[model samples]
Target: MVDGISFAIGRGEFCGILGPNGAGKTTTLKMLVGNAPPSAGKLWVMGFSIPAQARAMRRKIGIVPQSDNLDPDFSVVENLAVYGRYFGLSGREVRARIPELLKLAALEDKADARISQLSGGMKRRLSIVRALINRPELLILDEPTTGLDPQIRQNLWKLLRHLQKEGLTIILTTHYMDEAERLCQRIILMDHGRVLADQSPQALIRDSIESHVLEVHGSDLDHWVGEAPVPERIRCERIGESLFFYGERLDCLVASLDEWNGLNYAYRPANLEDVFLKLTGRELRDG
Candidate 1:
């Protein structure tokens, strides 16, 4: 259901498509991989037209879907063994790569364990490694670290960075602003099947939002708003009981609010979440 959604991913580039729930990120991904045909406009990947040359195009691509589609009947090693065979790999080749993939996913110890017995994080890691059995030139990951713990997520991040260094192009979708900032060189902000904005993470933060943000906490937000001196470049908003002041010069605003009690404050550089909320609005996207 996307319209005029066009963007390019360069070789060895790690691009993140970010949005709230039901923002068409998943739809866009399916169309790109030829799992769902676009209603209009041509979609291409690595110079090959999608949904038409899908069979040929699939050979050059690897996909890690949002859900873990592991076979419950099979063991961890069996899962990779069978998937590698689908790529036309020989028995010896599949065997040789299993250990490496298991090691990379940190599932070496669970090689003989059945899918039904593994933890959520272990299953997720195995799914990612399964997608790489063919050594695809372009990798597509849909919410790759959705249910992972911080330690496991960090491990995957390091592994992804290593793969990117090997000249593998990657495209992923995520809701985490910090993940997008840490992993993506360029990003597209999407909402309701449309692109809100697209730029490098740093550029998006600098250009879309103020350079500095001042956070204030108190019981009377409206009273504070009435007494607060407004600067030309500053924009203020309330989230719960806290007030956020967005402006280029946060220090000046901090000095102006010295007389306000219970207003503990701190200034921080702009982040992707600030730009995301500014462009897409602060409404809950439940779908």
Candidate 2:
């Protein structure tokens, strides 16, 4: 269902695709992997057109989907062994690589354990290793850390960084702004199947909106908005009982709002989440 969305990932670059729910993040990933065909426009991965060169592309890419699709009937090691076989690796080669991959995923101790016996985090780490069995030049992950604990999430981040350092181009889709900020050098923000903005996290935050945001809470947001004098450098929005004012001229905005005694305020530097909410709007996108 993705439409009119376009972006490129450079060699060895970690590019993050970010958007809220139903923002076409998953659809974009599908199109890139040739699982879904684009109704319009072109998709080129590693300079090869998608769906047309899908077989060739698959050999160059490794995908770790959002869900754990590991075979529940097999042991952790068996799963990796089977995946390696699909990539045409010999049994001896697969055996030699199994222990190393397990160790890399921190699952060497659980190699013989059935997947059903392992925890969610273990399964996630195993899935990542399985995708890498064929030594892909490009790695694609769709919301790779969803449903994992914070510690496990951090572990996955470390592993991803290690892979990126080894010259792998990584493309990931996520709703976690912090993940995008921490891992990606370049990011694409999408909403309602359209590309909203694309740039590095720091550049997007700096250029799309203000550096700092003043969050104001009060009983009557409209009353405050009506009374507050409009400043040329700032943009304000009312979300429920709060007001978000974005601008570089924070001191002036604070001075102008000093007369409003009922509103409690806090000033903080803006991040990717702020840019997302502003570009996509505050309305609840239930879809």
Candidate 3:
């Protein structure tokens, strides 16, 4: 259901697409790989037109799907060999790339293990490496770290950054605001099948939200708006039990915390999540 969304990515860039459920993130990824052809519009990848030169375009890019579809029957190394052949590599050529990919994924010892025996993080790491079997210039990841634990997610984040340093253009879709903010040099925010904002995280935070956020918890916090200091720049919004005050100057706001001594409050810089919630909303989204 995506409508008229367009943007171009340069080589060696790390970009992220952020959105709520049913925002056409997956559909857009599918079209890039030519799995779902665009009904109307020109689609190009690596200097080749999609669906017309899909075969050629695919050769220049790799995809890491949300799910780890590794065959439980195959050993980790065997998986790479099999996928390499899909790119028309000779058996010898595939074998030569195994050591390099395994080293990149830090799976040298686990190479002989059965896919079923690998941990969630290991499996995810393997999926990323499998996508690299073809040595693609561009790597597309769809919610790659959705269910991983924090530690594993951090590891994967480091891995992705390392890959980016190696000069690969990486495009990822993520629901984790911190992930997008930390990993992507640029972010494309989408909702309701359209692009809402496309810019760097810093830029988005600066433009879409105030510089700081003061969060307080209480049952009836809306009545406390007049109690905030320097109320001119502050914009207040209540979500559930917490009331957030956004503004450019927070010194006065921070001092106001003493007035409500018993109630709990925290103040920090505004982030991408704040901007996203401000732009889209704090409501639930059902597909």
C-alpha lDDT values of all predictions: 0.87, 0.88, 0.90
Per-candidate TM vs. native? 0.94, 0.90, 0.96
Clashes of 3: 0
lDDT, residue 220, model 2: 52
**Local accuracy of candidate 1 as per-residue lDDT tens digits, 1-287:** 66678787788899999998988899999998899988788888888998999878887789998999999999999999999988888999999988889988888899999999998888888988899998899999999999778987888888889888988898999998999999999999998789988899999998898898888887655676677667675788988778888987777667767777756777899899889988888987777
Q: How do the residues 23-107 of candidate 3 rate in per-residue lDDT, one tens digit apiece?
A: 8899989999999989989988889998899998898899999999998889999999999999999999999999999998889
By TM-score, the better pick of 1 and 2 is 1
Prediction 1 TM-score vs. true? 0.94
lDDT of 1 at 13: 90
Candidate 2 local lDDT, 117-217, one digit each (tens): 98888888899989988889999999999888899999999999999999999999998889999999998998889998889999999988889899989
By TM-score, the better pick of 1 and 3 is: 3
Clashes of each: 0, 0, 0
Error of 3 at 67 (Å): 0.8
Best candidate (score: lDDT): 3
Query: Which stretches of candidate 3 lie above 4 Å from their native place?
Result: 219-230
Worst 10 residues of 1 by lDDT: 219-228
lDDT of 3 at 33: 94
